[model samples]
Target: MNKYRITVADKNPLVLSGLETLFKNDDRFILTGTARTGAEFIELAAQNKFDIGVTGWEMPGLDGRAILDAIGEFEYHPKIVIYTGVPNPRIIREAMLNGAAGFYAKGDSTEQLITTVASVAAGQMVFPYFDLKKLQDDPWESLTRRELDLLDYLKTGQSNQQIANYLGLSVNTIKFHLKNLYTKLGVKNRAQAVAVSLSRKSNH
Candidate 1:
């Protein structure tokens, strides 16, 4: 059987050491590389082919989101698993929008982490623990498909004009949808709207 090849990146030395040790005894997964920052991880990723990339959302030099974006531009992209301390809905949403296979909080149990990685490697979506009912009850759940598309673009940190271009909609139409989304989500600005949307999705 072919062992699953994995790479990990985080700012903490202890976390890096711990992860290395954790995978060292596991025959199913081989830790191919480890890095102290996102930039280092990106450099390694560009040079090597990996089955999975486990990284913290926030790291020195380059953030996880930026790293994921860079990876997205590559012809060959590894399945990404964000093992982060930040479990905020916005972060999770951004990771998902960028094609992350899973999000696992640092506080999650070791078993949860292992299972999440395995699941993601097997091509499944994994979310950090959250209340599903709350997401269902959110007012934003009523958003139209167009609005959802706009919101998704917003979550990627795109400007209204950028969203308009990407969605092939006019600036006026983007503004109208943004207004409707803000009212429904009870948010006043693009950043707040994106945050609320992410929070709502995390509830699921």
Candidate 2:
């Protein structure tokens, strides 16, 4: 049997302690590292090799989504499993699209997480508690290609003027696109709009 090496990151000390205990007890897994902060998690991931990494959506300094965005394309990146409380459909979809092997909500039982980690480590795609079909039919429709590019910049916490400068578009044109983006996402204002936009995972 393969003993999958593991690394876990979470802000909660209690959760981390529980995970450390569980991983230590599991014969099929090797607990390589545990991280309590986003910065530490990033550093650990870069320095070690792990088969599976289970982490929360929000962490210290950098949130899980941002962490995924940072080193997602690295050649040694392990399969990621998101164990977060944020149930936004947008985030769930995005995480998968960005190479997350699984997404498990915090409300799910520990048994579910255990099974998901095993399945993901075994190279199976598993989304234990969320309904992908329901999200497809939800109020949030798919975003356009240009909209996705714009959304990427928005997630970096840039201003409209700065986005316009980066995208090589006039400020008024950026504002127009921003307005359209807001309307499509059904959110008011840029910050809320960006939050929803960044969280959305629709790939169509």
Candidate 3:
């Protein structure tokens, strides 16, 4: 039987070495290649088939999310594991929505890392520090999908015009949604709205 082939990508040399060593000691995983940039990972992924691709959230070029997006468009897409130093719930949710199989924080325990990879490789979702159930129980549950989208765009510091362009809505329509979102979120301004939304999201 063939072992599961894995590719690890990160901008940090130490992290790359550490990951290589960790997988090298694992019997079920074959560490096929390691890359220092998202571009390099994309090139390697295009040239060969991998069962899993582990990448950091932030890198010199392309970033992990962009890499995942590129891979999702390919005919042969491998399961993606986002290994990052940042562990924001919003970012984690975005990764899941973008086709990532799992998420692992860089400071997580070695055992946790091993378990997450194993579970993800077995076709299960793994989120190291997030609780999906709690997120579902947020008080903002009353907010509609469009309201949530508006809030998410607000959190990204997008102006009404930019949000309108991205969501393919007219500026007036976006403004209307923003007003409703602020009312539901009980905030007075964009800064307060974003703060309230993120605070509630983190409590989950």
Candidate 4:
């Protein structure tokens, strides 16, 4: 049987060591590399070819999202599996949107992790179960803190310039943030963003 090449990245040394040992013991998988930082992971990924890239979502310098984005620049794109302790609906949604193959919670069994990686390697998308309706209905969880704050400013009918002045950010910077905010909120413009926020607030 042809073994699948895999790379693992996490901030935790113990997690890296454990996964290295686990994959080494599994005849089906070839542990190509291990990284304790996202930068290191990206470097290793660039230097080697991997069938699957297993990594935590949160890491110092660069992140799972960054890694996913970086793959587009590579000649060979590896299937990414986010193995994060902080698994949230927003993270799952982002992973799905970014073409990640899997999102496995760290608390799950090693067997489940192995199964998830295997399934992904076999052209499958695996993610922890989450409420799709709730995720859609309350996209507030998807917003970054800056985005939430911008939403509040929008609610007050603050113009981008005014909001930027208040936040001590350049108008262009605010626009960049608003662009990301609108995407996350599934809105076209400020009016729609404010409307969605108000609608969600009224329900609570």
Candidate 5:
């Protein structure tokens, strides 16, 4: 049988040590490496040395979302399982849409983590329990990163000029992003856009 290659990443020393020990004990996996930060994991990933990457959602530099984004640029993409303490629904949803194979919370049992990693390595998706229908209904899922950033700035009640200056973008560029953002959120204007963003956040 071919053992699966696995890498574990977390900011906490104890968690990293624990996970390393856990995977080391399992006969099904070859513990490739462990990383204390997202950047370290990204470096490990770049080498294409592992088959599955089990990582924390929040890290010192890149974080889970950034890791997902960076993985897109790599030619050899390994499966990713986001193991987070917070387990925010929005982040979970985004991870799913971004091609993450699994999302495991720190609160879950280590045995479950093993099972999730195994399932994902077998080409199955394993994620925390969530409202699938609600996620399907959410317009926030349709927004691109740029449009999402613009929506966040809109939440702060900033003028178009201010946002443009802050982003180092022209007013026309900001307006264009906003127009797309509004359409994604099903809102007609800035006020409605902000309100929709807030409502979705509060629901989560």
Candidate 6:
């Protein structure tokens, strides 16, 4: 039988090594690549295709959310399943909204991990099932890195020019970001956007 190809991305070296060992020992799996950062994972994903991508919520250059957004541009979208220690409903909801077909919280058993990978690779959307209806319909999960950064600056009461200078982006570019940011945040202008951003931050 041909082994299922897998790639994993997590910041911790220990986690990387352990997962590598896990997959290595499994006759049914072939670990193709393991990365320490979301940026590296994206590069690796572009270079080689895999059966599934197992990622975490937090990463260096792009967080798992942004990684999902970036990969939307790829011609072939790999089946992504988040394997995260964070069991936050907010994060899990975001991952589900963003594009992860399934997730395995750190507390889940090793058997569950293997089963999840197999299920997702076979094109199943494996949610915990009970929590789907409870997940909020917040559009906040759709915000990209740049868009979130723009809103972060706005939270500090930065004007367009100030934000442009702070981010080292041109004002025209800032305006472009603002347009998309407004849409994603579901706000008409800067004030509403800032209020929404700050409110969400307090929740976290």
Highest TM-score against the true fold, candidate: 4
Off by over 4 Å in 2: 129-180, 186-204
**Which residue pairs show backbone clashes in model 2?**
90-199, 90-200, 90-201, 91-199, 94-201
TM-scores for candidates 1 onward, in order: 0.66, 0.70, 0.66, 0.76, 0.75, 0.75
Which pairs of residues collide in candidate 4? Answer: none
lDDT of 4 at 175: 95
8-76: candidate 1 lDDT, tens digit per residue:
988999998988887777787998899999999998888888899999988886787678888898888
Q: Which residue pairs collide in model 3, if any?
A: none
What's the alpha carbon RMSD for model 6? 3.7
- lDDT by residue for model 3 (1-204), tens: 557899999899998999999998998799989999999999889888899989987877677667888999999879999999988676687688788999999887977888898888888988756777765565474465467767888888989999889878799998898788777667788999888867877997
Reference-based lDDT, residue 72, model 4: 62
The order by descending TM-score is: 4, 5, 6, 2, 3, 1
Residue-level lDDT tens digits of model 6 in 21-65: 877788877888999999999998999888789888788877888
Better-scoring candidate (lDDT), 1 or 6 = 1
Evaluated against the true structure, the overall lDDT of model 4 is 0.88
Backbone clash pairs for candidate 6 read none
Which residue pairs come into collision in candidate 5? none
17-104 in candidate 5: lDDT tens per residue? 9999999999999999899999999998887578899999888877787888898788887899999898867778888887789999
What is the Cα-based TM-score of model 6? 0.75
Q: Model 5 compared with the native: what TM-score?
A: 0.75
Global lDDT of model 5: 0.87
The lDDT for every candidate, in the order shown, is 0.83, 0.80, 0.83, 0.88, 0.87, 0.82
For residues 1-204, could you state the per-residue lDDT of candidate 4 as single tens digits?
878999999899999899999889999999999999989999998999899989998877777777788876898879999999988888898888877999999998999999999999989999888988888777676665467778889989989899989978899999999999998888899999999889888999
